[model samples]
Target: MNREAIDILVHSAWKLLEAKDYLGARELYTQGLKLDPFDATLWNYRSNAHMKLQHPELAFTDAARGLQLLDDKLATTNLSPEDRNFSVFMKIDLLFRCLLAAENLDICQTALKYIDRLLTNSHLLSNEARQTILSKQKSLKLKIKTKRHAFARASDSLRLNLNDVLNLGTMRITKYPWNEFEPFNSENDIETELKEINIMLEPIAPKLLVVRM
Candidate 1:
């Protein structure tokens, strides 16, 4: 297609995006790519449209392609001011979304690694954008840390002391209201059990109350 036709397609697609008609935007972007298959800007817009549609895997694919095309263009000569800015923000945002869409820990970590690399390139991203990306990184890191810590704690708890745990081999876990007031059990027996538990927990309860205060 000629330059004018390509421009028209790109402009129309952009307007569709502005209206939040992601499916429409993607349709136009796909048509535009047919005319100028190597247009990184078109790919970037398409990627964003897919992202807004909650098609993260497709979004990541298009974003990666756009980045590759941008890198090739940069290798030959510098990007125009508008293109440069878009490239910078697109890289950061795409990585952020990709990280969020990742289902597994390994994929999340991989996406985060790329995000950190982008954050380090001070020349590409403005200070405000860098800070925004950094905040996202911090949140993802904390989530990962919490998940790992919980897993580790669970693993640790599994190594119980059989001596302290009565009838460790015969024990069966029960849901709360452990066993309904059994008709076979006397009120006195239930009261005695409750009293013993309260006595055992009495010292800890006072410490907990003080901490809460």
Candidate 2:
């Protein structure tokens, strides 16, 4: 309701944040936001405090709010270049916060989206910042690939093998009953005729191997 009081609250909040009083800073930011819910600065400050307190979900939400507010402000026509750049930097900062929160939450996909967004605004970034983001992008891609491979391996390892089910303690299974295989056209037909189809075959090394000692 009071602009002056809200400004005071924001200023005091920054001071507390600087003094490493994250709890106090968070409280002041929340009070200021209550008076002016759309204040981007308040949201940004509060997001930082949430991150300091290890609340990544809350931090991501607040940072996203700050970014949305800045985007609306930047869309207004006839803005001075100085004002535009100021808003641009603030947007970048909020985006970085979102990326950090996503990473802390182990949501690599969300972090990758934020990284791509930062890269889309590459013209606004300093050379050092651009380089850092590029490095992070590569690292994130590799991490995602690694996770995918591990999941694939785990799925194969955990799948139920019909051969194992048919194994008697005194005997070995030479073949699995393909008669029970799923996705078949008919339950009564034991054999299906092969259809002639055009296809390409590529030669590649096998992925997994076992050697008897």
Q: In model 2, what lDDT does residue 52 have?
A: 97
TM-score per prediction, in order, is: 0.59, 0.69
Cα lDDT tens digits, model 1, 1-213, are 366887898899889888988899898887877777667677677777877898765665566666666666656655688877666666655555545444222354555666677767756767886787678677778876775667566667698553344333221211111111212122566555654564466566621111100
Q: What lDDT does each candidate get?
A: 0.60, 0.71
Looking at model 1, which ten-residue stretch has the lowest summed lDDT?
Answer: 171-180
For model 1, the superposed segments whose C-alpha errors exceed 4 Å read: 77-107, 153-213
lDDT for 129 (candidate 2): 90
Which one is best on TM-score? Answer: 2
Q: Write out the backbone clash pairs for model 2.
A: none
How many steric clashes between backbone atoms does each model show?
Answer: 0, 0
Give the per-residue Cα lDDT of candidate 2 at 128. 99
Positional deviation of 139 in candidate 1, in angstroms? 1.1
